[model samples]
Target: MKGLFLDAVDELAAVFRHVARPGDPPMDVIERGEIRPEELPGLIAGYDFILDDHTALPTEAMRACAGLKHVIFLGTGARSYMNPEELADLGITVHTIKGYGDTAVAEHTIALMWAAARGLACMDAGMREGMWLRTEGVELTGKTIGLLGFGGIAAEVARIASGSGMRVLAWNRSPKAAPGVTFVDLDTLLAESHVLSVHLLLNDETRGFLSAERLAKLRPGAILVNTARAALVDKTAMLDALRSGHLRHAALDVFLTEPLPAGHVLTTLPNVTLSAHSAFRTPEASEKLLRMALDIACGL
Candidate 1:
């Protein structure tokens, strides 16, 4: 079977070339930024499967791509780009890679948490603009941090936060246990945490999980951090909380919209810190991600 690595941006094509084995399935790497849903049918013609990085493959458009049997998504958040169930009904199995960037993403989550706690971004931006801004910072040495979900990434985050002398509390949809991490009910997690870091995966049940009602439960002046899916929180409620000083600050690595539009309300918020959904971006993670994708293609 043949394969195509679709949407290999940010030098991923080079990484694919470096990790690909001689005996692996023959795959073509397309070094482009993004491909529209309408382009999928044509671009995937004659290819048995495609390795999608970040493309929108609407079910209607994918239905036209005859004989395309599989989609090897480069990341676990495949639902953000396509409806896997809809494609499954059309005989296209969508496969997602996980654990490839767990450590990389966890480290980034810690970075954002610290940055928000200390107002590092605001100070840096102010200094660059010829102003010396010094804001009061939150000391996390003995603070409580809540993890919304328990998973591979959250596990790594727990280790780092625990080692830094912060108390770790976690609430998962199901039961979980970790050394030095307390498993608590959602209500307890929300009310007691000084820093709330979201790690829940997005789905029908988890989308908007942190609604206005839930946001109201959080301790006032608590810092919010999300390196997981953006849809997990109510963006409107989050903005309102920030504006009213209900939340001390929010450090976000993911968003409701990618490449958040210019003049976006988030850019104007003094209490917001934004990263380009790049928590999982690192040389080590990139190499491991491509190697894992290639392994999936070989099995296909």
Candidate 2:
């Protein structure tokens, strides 16, 4: 099967060339930026498979790509870009790479947690605007941190946090075992943690899983670190929580909209720190992810 590395944005295209090898399938790179949902069918026609990094593939639009049968998503959260089950009905088997960037994302999550706790971003922004902002920050050591899910990334986070002397608490939909981590009930985890790091995947059941009611359950003044999909938390409720000081701060790597619009409300919030959906971006992780996508295409 021929494959197209759809939407080869510079960053991904750069690393993709570095990892692609001689034995790989005939995969063409579309040296364009992100493809919109409406452009999917037109741009993807003629390709039997696509190794997509961050393009939308709506079932309705994708139906127009008559010959396409496979989509090897470069990362785990393909659901944020399209419905795999719906695509499956169209004879398109969506494949995702797992464990490719666990350490990269885990390190980003830990970095966000520390930055939020210490108000680093806020201070940096203030200083850049000619203001000397000196704000007291949260001390993380010996504090309880809650992990909303137990996955490969969370396991790495548990390892790092545990090593740093912070009590790690986790709650997953299924049972899990990790060293130096305490598994707790959702409510217990919510009420006890001083810092809550989100790690749940985005899906029908998980969209806005951290709703207003659930957000209300968090320990007062808790810090929130979200490197996971943005829809996992109720965006509006998160804003209110940050404004009211119910949440001490929120450090996010993902947003409901990519390239979060300039002058967006979140950008204006002093208590929020933002990173361009780059939590899983590291040289090692990018190489592994692209290599894995190539492996899936080769198999197909």
Candidate 3:
């Protein structure tokens, strides 16, 4: 069946076109920048499938898309943008792609970890203001790093960090076995890790998973790197912890709000470094992602 590539940004649309080999399902591209929740039904009209990226499809609005049957979301965090079960009840199956950007994201995670450790962002900001900033950096070798969730991305991060001479630790809801990575309980991971990287998926149970109480348990002055969903942690508590210096730094790629509003509190904090949710934006990853999305669309 043919599909609509909704919210196709210029770069991603280019990737889709480059990867369009013969025999894939026909898909129309709409290079619309940012769609509101209220505008979804009309935009999605008459398509048998939708290739979605960064749009919230509220059930009420999606109920009006008469011919829609499938949504091939470009990333694994489909839950953050739409409720799969609710959409399924309306005969629209939400499908997400994973493992497409494991390396890209893992490399970004490592870079963020290094940047935070040495106050690289702070120094860069100072440099931009005509100041000669010589900031002391963190020596990552021999330091302990904790992975809050173990998945492909985390595994890649573990591989890179372990090779670079850091002690690696991981805690997952399900049991996992990775070479050179120590598996530990939540409290033990919290108490012992020098750098904690969050990789949990967002859902009802995982929403606000890192609460104030749990944040309190973390070893004070530890660095936090969250490439996962921002809803997984309590924003206010995280801000408080940063202000109080309980958290040495936070390198974030995801946020409670996308394009995190100007003058947001996180922006005001010097200890926090932000990326516009771009951990998975490399060309290799984008090519793989579109190829997978096309595969899902063809299957429908």
Whose TM-score is higher: candidate 1's or candidate 3's?
1
Q: TM-score of model 3 relative to the true fold?
A: 0.98
Please give the range of 10 consecutive residues that has the lowest summed lDDT in model 2: 33-42
52-132 in candidate 1: lDDT tens per residue? 988889989999999899999999999999999999999999999999999999999999999999999999999999999
lDDT tens readout by residue for model 2, 197-261: 99998888999999989999999999999999999999999999999999999999999998899
Q: Highest TM-score: give the candidate number.
A: 1
Model 1 regions more than 4 Å off = none
What is the alpha-carbon lDDT for the whole of candidate 2? Answer: 0.91
Best candidate, lDDT: 1
- Candidate 1 local Cα displacement, residue 186, angstroms: 0.3
RMSD of each: 0.7, 1.1, 1.0
Backbone clashes in model 1, listed as residue pairs: none
Candidate 1 clash total? Answer: 0
Candidate 3 lDDT over residue span 102-196, tens digit each: 99999999999999999999999999999998877779899999999999999999999999999999999999999999999999999998899
lDDT of 3: 0.92
Model 3 worst lDDT window (10 residues): 37-46
